[model samples]
Target: MDTLNCIECFVRSAEAGSFAAAARRLGLTPAAVGKNVARLEAGLQVRLFQRSTRSLSLTEAGEHFLREAGGGLDILQVAMANLASRQGQPAGVLKVSMGVAFGRLYILPLLKEFLARYPDVQPDWRFDNRPVDLIAEGYDAAIGGGFELPPGVVARALAPAHRVLLASPNYLAARGVPQKPEDLSGHDGILIRSPQTGRIRSAMLRSGDGRETPLDLRARILLDDPEAACDVALMDFGIILVAMPHALPYLADGRLIRVLPDWYVDTGVISIHFAAQKQLPQKTRLFIDFVVEQFRLQGLDRRFSAR
Candidate 1:
């Protein structure tokens, strides 16, 4: 058995906690992955995993080996990719994860140009709203926000994740527009319930001069997704507080209007995240630069801001 292949399988299985999950990532069958892992354990004469019908956990030896080998594996892979880039055009599957609405609105448009520029690089983009385990799930990169920066991952800011209050013209006309934060008492709010916290999202809208106003509105509809909240707001159901990336299209089309232009919720930044490697794969490097340059050319960073 190829020792490198066996080690790769072992590492992936340890990270994913199952052969099946590792197989999916490696583009191999579960049996192949398990066999590779078994081969590795046999050669070392040690049990690496505590395997059961439902679960797979790493043994003490496996845990220690992962700690020692994981970083080395990343470095080795990057080195190999770097050397491979010299032979020909950078070619491989570039798997990325991003929010559905944001990716479609921004990143998807760049696909045609990106392919035109680097035809050999195959794009395997996953549109997901939930936070993903980037390395464990085998994503080459991810674009979104609110991710905890783990040891080997890095994030590059693309835009401010500033959230703004929005209302449809029809809704505002009937329900009366709120001139001030305090005036939002009787208005119906399409509020987001945090998937991580299971609590309704709350905010203090801040202005340019550092003035803060508490956002206290009636939560008539609860939602987990921002795009869905935007859709509900478009139906004239109620006002919604959503990230500007989600609101920009509606705002441009006049379907939705910023309720209080000066004030917005300062959530954080929308970023493109990838692994922190000494040398990244050519495709990953190119993709990251392309996205960042596009954001710059589009002035998305400033546009997404609440100002």
Candidate 2:
């Protein structure tokens, strides 16, 4: 009787809520997972789960055993993984998700170097704007902004998710510049509709001198995509709000100029999100560390600072 396999099946089943879901994660049949867990219960002389046709749940004794044994099992598995990874290389498919524009611009460029470093590691990267369910979707990690941190997930902040109002020179000149936040009421605004909430975002901005003002601008155009809003601003349609990374190049090349340089929407931080666990798989850990290092090396945090 492999007690270790039984323990693993028990823990996975407890977290996944059913034998079938645990089997999907463990690459085993539901019957096999159930058999292993049954053997484990028999050895311990206790029933772990109260199983019914509709649902599976942990009993009091089962919960106690899981609480006591889960961390130990994780440590043991991590130790084994560390040893295996040292022998040759960390070899596995690392599935990750990131925002489309940001991923294509920054993350995609770094993959060649990452692959060169770990030839055995395969990268399965999803470039998307839609927020993902990390655990339910079986992703190793995810990166972006404003994602709800589900239970048993953690985040590492890579950059400030600071947003700035932007407008092309022609638009500003023709429409008349908004000298103060209150003055934006008369300006043409291209607003971003939140994909998650399905509502148009109207925000207030705070200046360096602690002056906060509500933005009551008229929305001539509303869209979900930030990049598209930038394009509309470039076409001299209206003022649009965009992230610093997306707006900086245009600010430099003079395609777009800041509408309120000292004022910005303090959205939050752009974070690399992953499952919160004591011992992460080697490849996943490496990728998280690597991306954080890249942000530091490139000065993305400072450049995108809301202050």
Candidate 3:
């Protein structure tokens, strides 16, 4: 009557096509496997298999159950593996997928410290603007900016990020800084379209009286890459709305000035995501902890400030 044992018996029977074959795989007696299957069917109040003296086949309901049950078993196995491996020394190649600009600005630098701590760990990093299937592509982890975790993956936030309105000093000097969000309607604005989602995003500004409004700028150029949009803004082409992390260095150097500082939008969280498994591997766990600490030390929480 053990639920796990019942699942094991059911999965093996489905794959082996017979209780006897399943019993062999499970190291249980054929009669035991048969009894477990019957007990499971009785508990669920549904017949899981059609059996005759010569042959065995799954019922339609059993077929559906098997599909769902098999996945659960796989997760159980993965969890066990992760827990067993946790206490051991982390080694081997760790595959990481991440967004290009953020990875370059944030994650890549942290890798040096991680590698120094775990000399045996080697990293395989892929940076792209587009999203990749972590399970399908066989990546151990991914750092990305988004609230929505892809299905079948577990995510943990590493840092917070916000979208802010930014413009070059020269452009602001020429066009004159907008005292209010509505004033953006008279200015040239650069829009950033996400390559992965193809969604356009702009910054909203708030006034001293707590009135919030969206800036309506003439879209002089539209680009999918945020860094490229920053480049365009640097050339004094138009105002750019970008994540604070991406614009930090430029803003600090006076090349770009943050505008509409009172208003901000959470672009997305920078997070580490992996397959939702019960047991995370030692290497993956170490990296996750390391990145979280790194972000904290970098003062990620205070990266944005109202001007």
Candidate 4:
């Protein structure tokens, strides 16, 4: 079998966790899938899978190989897409996942323009607050806050972002504004938790004099959605810390007030990430470039400039 075919088979099999599942996805027989994986293992002279009667797991060597090979595949796909764009129209499906609030506020509006420009391309979007495994889920790309990239993926920064402390004007008036980071402990706080990890996001507050204050407050309301948290803050429930972009419009409209402006909080990066695979279809590359350009044009980083 060809090297590209073998590599494709390996990735699919690994992601599916079984030869039968991978074969079903590829429309090939289970035996054919097994043959491809065997050929790939022989070429590399390593045992890639630990096979039991009913399950298959990656060996350590396979894990390492996937990381390196996946990146090469992404590069190859980018190159092919670039060439295809010059020849004709961009075509294929691009599957993307993102956070609910960010997607609804930003990406959804931009989709109209993107589709208008590349009518031949199709987009499949999934919006949720949960973190997804890009390769295992078979997504073409995903947009999210920057973190350490997982194995077998490549990440590109789309924009810079920061966490901001905010509360509604009514809330601040009733409870008083926090003059310092430590003051937050005395105020009612609406905490946002990650559904996938079940962990509350926390950050260190840095004063102008380089003093750092760690905040570990009990939330008056513990919730997972930022939009809901914002609503609670607006209704005078408590103060909330959220991404600056999501809070900017409210801040500008006098619905929300920024607190402790001099303190620096830990920032999150907005980025697009994709699997490292070879011979990427044209649609995915164009979509990524489009997103980056849109963020640039909108000056996404400026949302947190006041901080």
User: What would the TM-score be for candidate 1 when compared with the true structure?
Assistant: 0.93
Q: What is the lDDT, from 0 to 100, of the residue 189 in candidate 2? A: 88
lDDT of 1 by residue, 1-307 (tens): 2988899999999888899989998999999999999999999999989999999999999999889887788788877876766356677889999989999989999999999988888899999887788888898899988557776789899988898999999999999988888888799999998877879966888988899988998989999989899989989999999888888999998999999787888878898889887778889999999999999998999989888
Using lDDT as the measure, name the better of candidate 1 and candidate 3. Answer: 1
Q: Using lDDT as the measure, name the better of candidate 2 and candidate 4.
A: 2
Please give each candidate's TM-score.
0.93, 0.79, 0.71, 0.78
Per-prediction backbone clash count: 0, 0, 1, 7
lDDT of prediction 4: 0.80
What is model 3's C-alpha RMSD? Answer: 9.3
- C-alpha lDDT score of every prediction, in listed order: 0.89, 0.86, 0.79, 0.80
* Candidate achieving higher lDDT, 3 or 4: 4
Error of 1 at 203 (Å): 1.9
* Candidate 3 similarity to native, TM-score: 0.71
Residues 103-175 of candidate 3 have per-residue lDDT tens digits of 8887888877898888777798899877776754557898877557777798888766567789999999999
Off by over 4 Å in 1: 86-88
Tell me the tens digit of each residue's lDDT in model 2 across 192-281: 888788898767787877788776768899999888988888899999988887887788899999987889887788999998888888
